[model samples]
Target: MEEQEIYLLITRYLQKETTTEENEILADWITDSVDNEQTFEEIKLTWQHTEQIKLEESTIALARLKNRINHQQDNKAKTKKLVPFKWNAVAASVAIIGLFLVGLFYLLKPNDSVPTTYSVLKTRAGEIKTITLIDGTKVSVGPKSVLRYPSVFNNSERNVSLDGEAYFEVSKNPHKPFKVNTGDLTVNVLGTHFNVNASRNQILTTVSLLEGKVEVNLNSDKDDAYVLKPGQELTFNRANQRVFQRNLDSLNTLGWMTRTLNLSNDKLSDAAVKIENMYGVKLIFADQPTADTRIYAQFNGDSIEDVLTIICASGNLEYKKQGNKIYLNAK
Candidate 1:
């Protein structure tokens, strides 16, 4: 396909004027590479933002859009032939112009709503914080986490972005659905108590529900949403994009909030993972046999040393700490 044709097709696709065949072609092209998908997202975001701006401010918006596109072009200069330079530039320009014209036509459009202002809440390592949103929704943010939410939710929906982990007690609002976006997945709820863990280092993003119900939607597959009830948990593997749901421990899910460590017949290696996350420490095993040991225990509001002592005593194991690193071995 020619660059110009692809650009026109993309422009038509964005305008919702594409035929089924054209849409299929565009979809195939986007799915062909990650770069194509990212480029499409950038153009889409720019087009959407332009629509929200007033006609009088369109010149500034256009300038910003062009600058952003140019910056992207510079970044992709070495691989210009990947998607064809003309296609990206032309598509971006056409989309921006189309949005500006649409905004102009809506100059007399009734202003029924105000824009939302977002605020960011964050917690550093070894820190935990609790916050109540404007809608009375409570969020308990875990260590090394960030939550970005609007000061006031939109009339139709409550949306927030989260990274790392948080326990959410959503305020019941039947008219407005609540959504928690964690980059690759979105958790939707009318009113629910749920815990979400989306740490960057982990291979899986987990959502554990304690009360009411919630729906989790994978960004890669919108139709593959998973609905969960209380006592259920959904895990989305980032590496393979696989999703699985199973029964979960509601109390254990809130362990971070209560300073409790629950290890119900867990393997030593698995327990080490929990300890590492909870205490922000590194666990080194002296040998494979020792690391494979199993233990069943619960440490409620116990110090790391105390918990380790109990584990070691139960399995006849030994451990020594050197700064932030702990080494374990069989006695």
Candidate 2:
């Protein structure tokens, strides 16, 4: 989670507006690290102090605090010698009070400025869904996917969490970049169209850009980031914690959106995953060689059996069906 979103969550927690799940999320984040715990404690303390002050005084007090902070920063920059640290009780108390008001000033802002809560959208196997966010961003969620987004985005940025695959058509807001948080990486964009395949079951997380530029960075190492231009794709391997980029194929990357299964030199194993995701069935190879065989095929709005039959024929393979599981072997 971003720092700004953390503040919004803390504010919601303080106001008793958080849901049970939200409370748990906040608790987990707080316990994740010492820095997170300290941040939560500081915000909690500041909120308590702010409650004692009148609401009308928040703006003036916050203004004064900003001015004081800016003045101190300027002084520190101009002076070469470090100032001696002396504990003045009165001055310290006044400074703490100033921060208290600053916290209140932000928390008490208009409702639209921050999200009071979040909503979760999920799609079952073989199902696809789409939603429009408060910022006019459109998201088409793929099968077996989960997406969590705020009711209203904070003024600074738009944040959302995703699991599985999603195609995004983000409304342009250069001032507030849109971010998608997946399990292993984050995709940052300033109003662009993109497809993110970060499914939990998949070992590789892929981010494909269709229209605009996007920055993909690993959660473990933010500095290890890749900027992808249009028609480019970035793949992050979770097992190796490595990333590689390649030119993206629109049909292969986004065919699911239109019920078009386009396989351009896809390995049999990889093609099986696509079929399983679309038809909610399981595919198993009888041998490793058959799984490794690559095939090129396309199926537009075809039934699961038809799609599998064509693939098996093209690869000189045969498949046996037992319930929802399909086993493939070399013919």
**In terms of TM-score, which candidate is strongest?**
2
What lDDT score belongs to each candidate, Candidate 1 first? 0.75, 0.77
lDDT digits (tens) for residues 1-331 of candidate 1? 6655665666666566776556557756654555665555444444545557666665554455456557776787566445434534644675545643334222323573335568898886657888766455779999889999985464468899999999998877676789999988999998889999997777989999999999999988889889998899999999988888999976688887766877767789977766776777788998888888888788888888998899998778999999989999998
Error of 1 at 147 (Å): 1.5
lDDT of 2 at 277: 81
lDDT of 2 by residue, 1-331 (tens): 6544565667766666776567657756764554455456556645755756675777665565456545664676544322332224324445444444445555444561432578899988788998766545779999889999986565467899999999999876666789999979999998899999998888999999999899988999989779999999999999988788999989878988777987778898877777888888899998899999888888988998898888888899999989889989998
Question: Model 1, residue 98: what's the lDDT?
Answer: 64
Query: Residue 54, candidate 2: how far off, in angstroms?
Result: 27
* TM-score of each predicted structure versus truth: 0.62, 0.63
- Error of model 1, residue 320, in angstroms: 1.7
Candidate 1 regions off by >4 Å? 1-117
TM-score of 1: 0.62
Worst 10 residues of 1 by lDDT: 100-109
Off by over 4 Å in 2: 1-115
